[model samples]
Target: MIHLRSLQRLTLAQRRRTATGLRAGTILLAAVAATLSRAPAARAAPEPVKVVVVANFENGADQGDAPGEFQFWVEREHLDHPVALRGAPDVLRRGRDGLYGMVLRHGVTDLAAFILDPRFDLRRTYWLFTGISGVDPRSASVGSAAWARWVVDGDELREIDDRTVPAGWPYGLWAIGADAPNRLPSDPNHFGSVTELSQLSKAFPLNAGLARWAFDLTKDVPISDDDAIRRARAAWNGFPAAQRPPFVLMGETLGSRRYWHGEPRTRWAEDWVRLWTGGRGVFVMTNMESQTNQEVMRTFGRQGLVDPDRIMVLRTASNFSEPPPGVPVTASIGDEGPGQRLAFDSNERVGAPVVRELLAHWTRYRDAIPGRP
Candidate 1:
């Protein structure tokens, strides 16, 4: 049974096209409000932060101990004017130099409101979404990281119960205007399908050039793996990516709040990302926050509050969305281990270098995109 509150919020966003998929019928969690107010991010016309590090949640022991996401990004920098936004708690950290950091509450509402906040000077900043997510076992393993080239929304679709779906149907899901799975959506532009490609019915493509540059810089960085992950990965000895030690890769991501799992859902995620990107994107990570974040950018991009070209998303594998060959989905759903720590470590490893570069040469990046050296 779907949560009434979840469905209610979804309905609200669809009705109010620009609504931040939050506050439709749901109350904003205090966590979201408290996070941004912790420091007090403010400034009428203060110096613009060059880079902003965005992390979704602070859970587990690593997160509890660290001052912020990726640890060093916050500890090493000095933040000023922690202006708290009313609709959401958007804590902005001004690096000891010129960088910034924010820990986002795990929801679409806060994500959208923060950018629209008057205090955020996104014009001269590089918004880097740094977080961990579930990886497709066929594509990656714990500790592996990916730079997203495209972000697809998997939630905007019509569906029938699997039990009542027609024969040969993959699942009960299909495009909003399409007749069946894998078919062209009839009303691609019904709402905000303006960018829908022939193959993708609901999606957004970030700056391809920027994604390439980030991938090129960190593709070869050595990713540390551990015995816990190795032993966990042993269950998937047949899958090359899952068996190999963690590494960095360039790929695409999908975001949805449904949190479905197992092979069928995994296949849907892969196909959805591929179909949306028209075969150019490789699907790897599954996220819950990116799609909402993208929506906010798209909404404000028109008002000159945001630059879609200046944004990038980085995802690291904390666990597989589905169990391996023999493990059941039920067992894998709640199984816990060191994947959390590995995810934190790898996310920082793959993303820190880029953050450092932007901080070191803020003058060059403030007015221009950096070229690959």
Candidate 2:
């Protein structure tokens, strides 16, 4: 019934509509494909830790065992969450409070690994290194605690046989590039031909202001004391500091792998710390691991994994570095007696307050470090 021209015009209109529909479908498919391609892959953010309590070792289990450097912290802090460290058997425990405690055994390597672990975001975490040290009687009595400004390494020295050292030289240990004992090396970068010690000096300085802040904050905390330590303190006659009851002080720590004991060695530690710190530091405590740990921390800091200025070293006196008058070095070397318990107690009492304060003021402290203007 219709004309041929009208039928042809209708077919052309239908073709144009079909073409528009296909073009629109193609544009929508392209957009959807592009959106799918540009979508981000799923990823997890790193875990945040505000405070890390770095303890050297623990006596036994993490809980319900004889207390070690980590026990009182774990027990008192209620650090019940056990997070297994990747590639290591050790566990990093956490508390409901923003505190993390780990007892490191393989000193530097373990610490370095912990810091480099991708699982933790430690950029703002503060490190509190707490341990018992052989207390210098001249610095403090047993059970006393010291906030350290410097951790001087007693290792990394050239040693000749003490019996063969030149006359008047106190001990065999001397700087790597120095000619005599108690002397500084002209160039810190070179550690002889055999050992390349780099420019990292033996003196590992902590934030002086922070150390003072901690000392002032807890100086009045009642340090635990016992009759055995009291009686032992009496043996240190003529040494005024040793004779006094346990109290907090600001002092430096001398760390050496060798557990050297005796009056002569004590004198060496004193001189060594003074020598390394340019006489600005005095040796008050002796330990086996501070230097290694601090050195690792410094490296991590440089790597942007941590803030080195936030590090604090707190040493409680478990025993005297040297024997008391009339006691043989061999006899008193390993006799911590009641001083160990007192030191443990002091560590908790003195350290807990700082931890609590940090937690309470995290809103402010999270951005601004304490003792900084």
Candidate 3:
């Protein structure tokens, strides 16, 4: 009886050992399978294709004001590739300001979204922003279109009261001249001083075909009518020192009131321009009346949308300069009215030629630059 009981106990112990081995094997197999399943998912995603984004313009005449208006027209009329319109979100969110935020809000919600969204190919896309900017009174006249070399936030400068306190500003007109060799140092408040694609032949290389196309398209378009020039010069002659708007005052005031105090504006301008030019661009606008241009351009640069070499700034005349003591005074011609109206319309009419040139240039640039497409 005792031998039989011991035999039974040994048999039970063997069974228990077998069961323990089986359970251990099962657990080990499950862990190995789980690890293998995650391997593919852990791989990094591919880079997204570059895309140009144009947002709806906030101000100006609705007809020619929106960035997308010109961008869509140009893509349809000029580019051979697909151009997609990004939707604008209504909810105002924080952490997005200037042109970067505008592109994010209106075109693509985020850069990552642009990368992951099935609609866009990660490896083959790019973007550009196209729109009109107010000409600096000192340098460029009304009706002239310019490409940015650099975009600086006018509000980033120091200010006092409602005026921009210029003592330690990082991106004032003076700083612009110090950076760009082609720019003249005379007028600091003017937008024309910003470096443009036309001027930066080396660092921000221009596609010769593109430059030729831009020149050809814009060449025939009259920059100024004789009558308009006469009127502008006449208006300047008439304005007295006390009545004339000061250029420095314009920059200072714009920096203090509009850009510094409020939610950052001007992201659309920066993003679109940066995308179109492949990352190097600049902007020009009145410091006092419209920092929108400056703010937007600056935002694009900061966002990595633009290539660093392709940046510059330019300004026209300073509205801040006081006229001579005895000059006759007339109402300011700064506003875009009847005379400026024709300039915007002319873009639509002559845009075909410009489109042709742009396409040709883009093709040539793609060919010249090894990795661009």
Winning candidate number (lDDT):
2
Candidate 1 per-residue lDDT over residues 26-103, each given as its tens digit: 222212222122224564564455787888776432223743344544544444435455555444445566666777
Residue runs of model 3 more than 4 Å from their true location after superposition: 1-116, 122-127, 162-233, 238-284, 287-334, 337-340, 346-354, 360-363, 367-373
What Cα-based lDDT does every candidate model obtain?
0.70, 0.76, 0.30
Estimate candidate 2's alpha-carbon lDDT, on a 0 to 1 scale.
0.76
Angstrom error of the Cα, residue 128, model 1: value is 0.5
Top model by TM-score, which number? 2
**Model 1: residues with Cα > 4 Å off, grouped in runs:** 1-44, 60-72, 76-90, 106-120, 188-201, 371-373
Higher lDDT: candidate 1 or 2?
2
The total number of steric clashes, by the backbone 3 Å criterion, in model 3 comes to 63
Model 2: residues with Cα > 4 Å off, grouped in runs: 1-41, 187-189, 192-200
* Model 2 vs. true fold: TM: 0.85
Tens digit of per-residue lDDT, candidate 2, span 51-161: 888788888797798887888888998888876654334747888677888888645445644664556789988789999999888889888999999999887778888
Query: What's the TM-score of every candidate structure?
Result: 0.81, 0.85, 0.40
What does the lDDT read for residue 65 in candidate 3?
A: 48
Q: What is the C-alpha RMSD of each candidate to the true structure, in Å?
A: 6.9, 18.9, 20.2
